[model samples]
Target: MSFIGIKKNITQKDTAEKYIGDVSTYISNNYSNNIKVHDIAKYVNITGAYLFRLFKEYLHTSPQQFLINFRMEKACELLKDCNFTTGQLARSIGYRDVLLFSKIFKKSFGISPSDYRKQL
Candidate 1:
């Protein structure tokens, strides 16, 4: 009696896989902009709540955490160019707040952006 034929048709594993793929693609494609969970979920025709649940159940993390890690990873790669300042790098990875970017960056790498560039 379900709209999608049956409730059993949509297993957690299937939903998790679909969510992961959609989120990964959306982030990879729009990491330079202000992306959000609601936007990605809407794009994939799913509810934001479902996206959060799938991310927590399968990935063991929230969408926001995943996005932060993804952005930090991208920022590290971009750092190799040695042409961007902390603010520039932060903005480059879709973060407008340099303080927040520095906090997240230190949390991920155990070093501040200035210290990171000094090491390079």
Candidate 2:
């Protein structure tokens, strides 16, 4: 490729990386809120479909999956150190329904959050 073509490729790669980083940072900063894929796309100035593609290409996961994983990871950290009830823990991690949160926790870690805490 020509120098100009190489430069363009680098710039495109950089922009793609920046968008992914922006999405990740936004999720990390707002995982405690009831945020959605559309909200995240808006924050990053992209369409939701594009956001999905970006995450799928770069992270090998859907954006929604990434968000869920992020929330679950954060929940694990909080559960380790905080004396939060299940409901409180759910809300703290952006889950309004304790049952749903528990379900996801069980799916992710093969145990309920309470059980996970008990083990901890």
Pairs of colliding residues, candidate 2:
none
lDDT of each prediction vs. the true structure? 0.86, 0.93
lDDT of 2 at 101: 91
Q: In candidate 1, which residue ranges exceed 4 Å CA deviation?
A: 1-11
Determine the C-alpha RMSD for candidate 2 after optimal superposition of all C-alphas. 1.1
State TM-scores per candidate.
0.84, 0.94
Tens-digit lDDT track of model 2 for 1-120: 999999998998898899999998999899999999999999999999998988888789999999999999999999999998989989999999899999999999999998899898
Tens digits of per-residue lDDT for model 1, 1-120: 785656565675686797699789988999889888788888888998888888888889998889999998888888877588889999989998999999999999999988877788
The candidate that wins on lDDT is 2
